[model samples]
Target: MRLSTYEIILPLVGTDEKPIEGYTLLTNGLYGAVDVVPKEDADKLQAGDFAGLPAALRERLMLRGHITRKDEAGELADLKLLSRIFKTIQGRSGVGLVIMPTYDCNFRCPYCFEQHRLKKGQDWLDNTMSDEMIETVFDALKDYRARGYMVNGCSFYGGEPFLAKNLGVVKKIADKCREMDLSMGAITNGYDLETYLDFIEEYKLRSLQVTVDGTAELNDRRRLHKDGLPTYDRILRNVELALQRGVRVNLRVNVGKENLHGMKDLIDDLKARGFIAKEEERAKEEEELRKTDPQAKTKRGQFSYYFKATTDDAHPEKNISEQDTIDEMMKIGFTAEEAVARQSQYNMIWNRMKNLFKKEGYPDFSPAYCGAEMGMLVVDPFGKVFSCWDVVGKDDQATGYIQPGMSRFLWNFNKAKWRTRTVDLIPACQSCPYAFICRGGCASRSSNAYDDYFREFCGEIREIFAFTASRLAGQEWEKRRAAAAAGEASMDACAGELTLSLAGPASRFTEAERAKIMETNSQKEMFDIVKGAAFFPEPE
Candidate 1:
């Protein structure tokens, strides 16, 4: 047997009262299993002294993928095969279409990435999708559905989708979605959300993602109107109105050095408005309902918020690194875990790994970072279709075009280029330990950084993964310790259930083999007796 290449080992720093000394936390990046073992056992495994370990320990290690059969092909090969299967499944699952009604905006945020497209006298500003175009878009969706691509939903995107002038187009699109039995959502500035609340409620809008840079003072200075008027109060009021009308609001706080200090005040303001309390209550109610009905759907309109690091190439000095933002978040009364959760991208990877450790199933592996490489297609006002939202307005970056008579989008080589950009194709990502998790990073960012779509634009991914693994390991160690204390037979506090499936011909193990391994020993029970005793000592 040989140790997996993706093993991450760290020293366990227990509490002052009960120091978990001489133990190491180990995790496999690919398998997403976490365990605590004695330092000597880890050393023995590293030294390739498998015979020196107990038979039960060896069996457990193999089961968790910490150690694999020497004849096995390897984890990297398995990951590549799994990723391809995942991509194939994603392509058929559904297509998430982004509709840009108009490129015109009511706000002129200094750090807006779409500023170039919103310039004065630009044709993009005057280009709004006509009612005919809206009808054509829905027709294209129906065509895609007929072609075997499920129509997942439609999301409104633009310089600002909720601009007062674009209300007619927005309503038309929402009405079509309602007619098609499709869910509708939007990414808007929220200043004009109140005007659309009636439509939002009527169409059963699933969600709205709105950005609020900071508290009123900080936000007003940042997300200002085109004429330099304050937008904070009006936006907040409209957000509250949307919530009252049963529209889920995802409040995004753009954090930078300039407004990082105001996050606490912003969160405090949200709490004062009862937004946080409402979300907490909704969460509790949903948890209770799910206890009775595992598949029960929860009501919409719960207000939740996350912090995102601002990106401003024009004002590089004002932007804060993600780590710095997390640290600042910690200073503002967030735990390390909570602060990490604020970064959506990192949090997504962290959550996937966390879920993998808790459940008995393979990670939802993907070769691409997001839907750009999957089935996501963004259509702008002028019939330009893009694979990535960041390149929506750039003609050269457009993947295709759509017109009134076209039954389907007229895709070009650019679409294939985007669809084929996966971790396997990226040379750097192939051998990288976090290849499956990072998936070659964002395609647009990669192109912007290396001037090539296929190159690696690994931005803080290693650091993020390290932090995530450490946090996950620490949490798992604590769970096992608690389980031992409570005299539980398993470390998994929840019911143990695992799902196994075959990927393709190249897959290492069959479904039956996977099931057999799972039945050998419960993951928790494998570590239940480490070196002839429970992992944790009994209380006095």
Candidate 2:
């Protein structure tokens, strides 16, 4: 039997600052099942000598089909595996669909990527999705349903989705989704949310991805009205109302060098305004939501926050490196280590890794990073269809268009082009450990930056992993120290759970309680052991 090419060994360290006897082995190439083997067995398997390993361990490795039989042929090639992923993606239902009501946006953020597209007179207003385009969208949805596929939901994307002018288009799409029994979401700037609150409530919007870079002063410099008026207070008020009305708000903070220091103040202000309310406050809100919105699963607890590193634009004046932003965050309050580590912990890469791990049992794998390749088609104002929102307004990126008297879209080569792109096509991604999570990152970003479909920002990805690993290693050290007190030399029982808990979900605790969980490990160690022990009830 031969080891899978995708299997990787990550060294684990114990209390003595030395490598633990065993390594943590993870498999990726198979496109099915995730196996984690302890170090001793991994060592034996690595040497092609599994004689001393436990029967169950060997049987599992064999059962998972990662290990190839000497009598049978070896594992499938990358190209073959990729083909399977593509076919799998094509067959799936509840695929995500995004529609841009209008290219017009109220806020003019400095780093807006669309600015470049708009600079050459893109004619955003005239390009808004029309009634005819909405009919074409319904036609597409009906076609999908006939093909035995249901859309997960519709997302309203825009220069700003909640614009007063776009309300008709938004309502039309939402009405169609309701008729088809689908959920809905939006990526709005929040400036016009108050105007759309009734529409949001009527459709029971699942979530809103809103940007609030920092406080009013810092944010106004970037996200401003075309009239150059400040929108901070109004946006915040709308955000609070959304949460109170049971809509989960994913507050996106676009971090850069200029606005890095404003983050602490933003957090403080959010807390003070009851935007980031206490548990009791959240509980009260949820209780009210239960009566008014039984269909809404967006509880107060799910109103989360995220930090996105601002992407570089043609305008170098606004460009800032992630490291610079991290350093500035450290200056504000976070420790030098935490400033770097937090970015990784909360990054999309890490989130995708966690989801990939969950897929071991769930098996809900996504062939592409998003729905762009398989099921999703972005319909712009003029009935132009694109693969992603990033390329919605670009004429060259349009895959097809909704023409009169057409059963399907008028043919475009790019449709087939994006659908066929998988890890196998990119030599760099084929061998990279994070390939499954990144899916070669954003294709548009790669093409624009490298002028190659296969090239990606591998360096930034590696740095993020480095920061996460370093922080995890520090946690391992604390686990060892705690295990030492219990006269245990190994982390087999409680230590593994304690170390993994950090990655599982964020838990709320008082400052003193958090100290115990992090420093002493008394509370966390006990909690992990009990939770792990009783994960499943004893057989009756």
Candidate 3:
């Protein structure tokens, strides 16, 4: 038997007051199991040198998948299985329609990538999506529904989706989604949200991802209006109103050198304004709301914040290293663990895996990382369709387009390329231990910035994973010890069920289709990293 590729091993150290020996922490990234084993046994198991270990110990490892009899060919087979499962899921999943109604945003944030284009005298206002294009989007959605796919939801995107000029277009799309019983979400600047309360309630807008940057005073310096007016207070008020009406508000802060430290202040402001509530407090409030008014939408769906490190390849002067940005969060107030977790997407996944958080069930295992694949398409203002929001404005990135009188959408290889981007297909990721979780990292971002699908801004993904696993392992160990002291039989017995399941109709794949996917072809060779066409020209 051999260890799984997803295993992460770390030295099991004792408390700071004392020292312990002959133990190591073995964690399985896939199965989410952490165990402390004798150093000698660990060494033997790792080296496939199981000579002196007891049968019980060996059986336990094998059952947990810490040790498996699988050979290299078996490992490859597992990956193929996973890839097929992903493809099956992708085939049946709901189609995400991201509509960019306009390219003109009111915000004049200095760090915005689009601002560089604005300075170059680009007439983005004139490029707004025509009414005919909006009609085309509805036609496309109908086509998807006719093809046996659910029109899952609509996401309103663009320069600033909430801009006054775009309100009519927003209302049109929102009304259509409501008519079809689909949820609606938006990525807006949040300045004019007060004007959309009717649309929000009538259309059942579920979520709004708005940028706050930092606290009121600090954020106002960057997230300003086109006329240089401060927008912090207006945004805060609007977000608060949305929360009161049962909308989930996600405050996306662009963490950089300037606003990194200010994040703490912003978080504190949110706490004071009732945007964040402690677990017990939130539970009490929710119970009270249920008792008083059973039909009320929410009592705890206020808002939460996420941090993204600022990057502007079109203007390198605005970029900051991920390490530096994360360090600033730690220097200000967050612990190293919190800093790392909050700075990344799906931060709750770490806690869920470690058995600390349980609000949502364990994450469902799916190969699709983002909307770029699985037909989550973006229809730009000009009727150009791209695979993801990140590639909207670039003409070269558009997978297809709709002409004024065309009865159907055009097709391209870009959409097909993204459709096949599974973890096993990435050259740099194929042999990497964290391939499943990383999932080849934002394809458009990697391709745009580094001209390679697997490359990231920092290549420190492994380090981040290692740090996260170690911290979670330590937390789990302490919890188990506490349970033992309290006379519990074992922590595992009370830890509740954890499930890992594949997505969609894998059982229904025809043998012919399976054989075609299983064949070794040019698609396999496409994994090799290579720079091809530059979608955008260099700035003068």
Could you say which candidate leads in TM-score? 1
Ranked candidates, highest lDDT first: 1, 3, 2
Model 3 agreement with the true structure over 146-251: per-residue lDDT tens digits: 8777787888888778776667877777666776777789999999999887677767688999898888777888787878888998998998788766778888
Clashes of each: 0, 5, 0
The clash number for model 2 is: 5
* Candidate 1 root-mean-square deviation in Å: 8.3
Candidate 2: which stretches are off by over 4 Å? 1-3, 12-79, 82-86, 89-94, 120-124, 278-280, 283-302, 315-367, 404-407, 454-459, 465-540
**Model 1 CA deviation exceeding 4 Å by range:** 12-20, 47-51, 68-75, 119-123, 281-300, 490-540
User: On residues 205-261, what C-alpha lDDT tens digit does candidate 2 reach at each position?
Assistant: 989988888998988987878889988899888887887677878888888767766
Clashing pairs in 2: 22-39, 23-39, 127-381, 128-381, 129-381
Clashing pairs in 1: none
lDDT of each: 0.74, 0.63, 0.65
| Number of the top lDDT candidate | 1
Q: What is the lDDT of candidate 1?
A: 0.74
TM-score between model 2 and native = 0.74
lDDT of candidate 1 over 372-409, digit per residue (tens): 98888899987889988987778888988888877778
What ranges in model 3 sit over 4 Å off?
A: 11-23, 28-40, 90-92, 115-124, 271-283, 289-296, 299-301, 314-341, 346-348, 351-365, 404-408, 454-458, 490-540
**How do the predictions measure up, each by TM-score?**
0.85, 0.74, 0.80
